[model samples]
Target: MFRLAHISDIHLGPLPRLTPRELASKRITGYINWHRNRRKRLFGNILESLVDDIKSAAPDHLAITGDLVNLGARAEMDAVAGWLANVGEPDFVSVVPGNHDAYVPGSFKLACRAWRPYMLGDDKPASSAGENLFPYLRVRDNVALIGVSTAHATPPFMASGVFDRRQARLLRTILRQAADDGLFRVIMIHHPPVRGATQSYKRMLGIGRFSKVLKEAGAELVLHGHTHLETLYRLPGRSGDVPVVCVPSASEAPGGHRPASGYNMLTISGGPGEWNCRLERHGLDAQSSKFELFHSEDL
Candidate 1:
């Protein structure tokens, strides 16, 4: 069996000192939010514990769906790169950016560059695709891991994501190619594509187009993390229901309004027409101050 571990929304903390210029735009709002509220709920220590647990589990591969930084600061991105190095090498970890990673204009480029190594596909070099490489495919064993970016800069107080026409077109092609190869396809995005999974202000746009692509090309599983809550939903595929899963922020401290930080361990065995999947959830146990299994089931 192949084991894949999934985590998201790190929101790595201890915000670096921002120059007046850096906080002059949309970042001002996020900075205020962090200082007033977010920082209390998201802790680096919690993230460290989660990572340690993940290391002990030692899944064959790891997927981080996004929000590595809170305000999308250049220094934050640099720090997150260092953190990623500690997590694992780029080849073993796959990542996609989140709305906060693109909180301000031009920040998206910085995130893409900083996290490029983790988001790259096995088949194509990062140099060849430059910054436009979305729907990247990494073929591992009998699985096809596809990474798609819904991250985009938005106005203040709007934490929305977008899957534009270009991304949709490429995603369709990638899904088709993976299906043709008879591999179990897993699509990774930062935002939950299912409607009502997020508030209206934070909703993912272009989901109809995305659904159409899925309907035509199909995928075995979809994973995301932006709502800071655990979610499980299925979208219709021609052959069967596609499982879409989400987990809470990896850095979220216990006793928050949202559920404690957690991650998913997915075990897949067998092949295309006769595949088997077991999903195990690990999350912070607030009273015990440790991470433990909170849920488990077959999907």
Candidate 2:
């Protein structure tokens, strides 16, 4: 079986001090929010423990669905680069950006440049420049991981995402190609594809277009992280329903309406029309102060 570990919304904390010039734009709102709220809940120690737990499982590949930083600062990206190194090399890991990763203008480009290794397409030639756009594909074993970017800078108090027409068209092409190869297609995005996954202000803007492409192109599974809650939604596919799974923020402390830090372990085996898969949900246990298995289900 091919084991894949998925985690999202790490929201790494202890944000670096922002200069006066740095706080002169959209980042100012994020900075204030982080200091007043997120700093206390998204603990670094919790994130450290969660990563250690994931490493112990030793999945063949890791999928991190973004929010690796608080304010999308240069220092935050740099810090996450080292953290990504500790998690695994680019070949063993795949990532997609989230709304927080693109907190302001230009920050999204900066993140893409810094985290290129984990986001580039696998089919690119050796001499090809590594600047592949979104809707990149990485083939490993019998699985095709199709990643799309929905992250974009938004105004104050808004955490929305956008997947433009260009990305939607390219994603449809990639999905069909993967299907033709008889591979287990797994679509990864930072925002949930299903409606009502988040509040109106934080909703994905082009989700209707995304869903239209998915229904036509089809996929075996869809993985996302944005709501900071554990959720499951099934969407229409060519032959049947496609499973869409979302996990809580990877660094959320226990208590409150939001659940604790958690991740999804997906095991895929068999082949073609007879595929077999399993999902294991792991989360921090506040009473035990360690990560533990919360549930397991077949998909």
Q: Per-model C-alpha lDDT, please? A: 0.90, 0.88
Question: Candidate 1 regions off by >4 Å?
Answer: 128-131
Residue 237 deviation, candidate 2, in Å?
0.8
Task: Please give, for residues 182-249, the per-residue lDDT of candidate 1 as tens digits.
Answer: 89999999999999888999999998988898899899899999988888999987578899999989
Q: Report the Cα lDDT for residue 177, model 1.
A: 88
Winning model by TM-score: 1
Clashes of each: 0, 0
Clashing pairs in 2: none
Prediction 1 TM-score vs. true:
0.98
Error of 2 at 272 (Å): 1.1
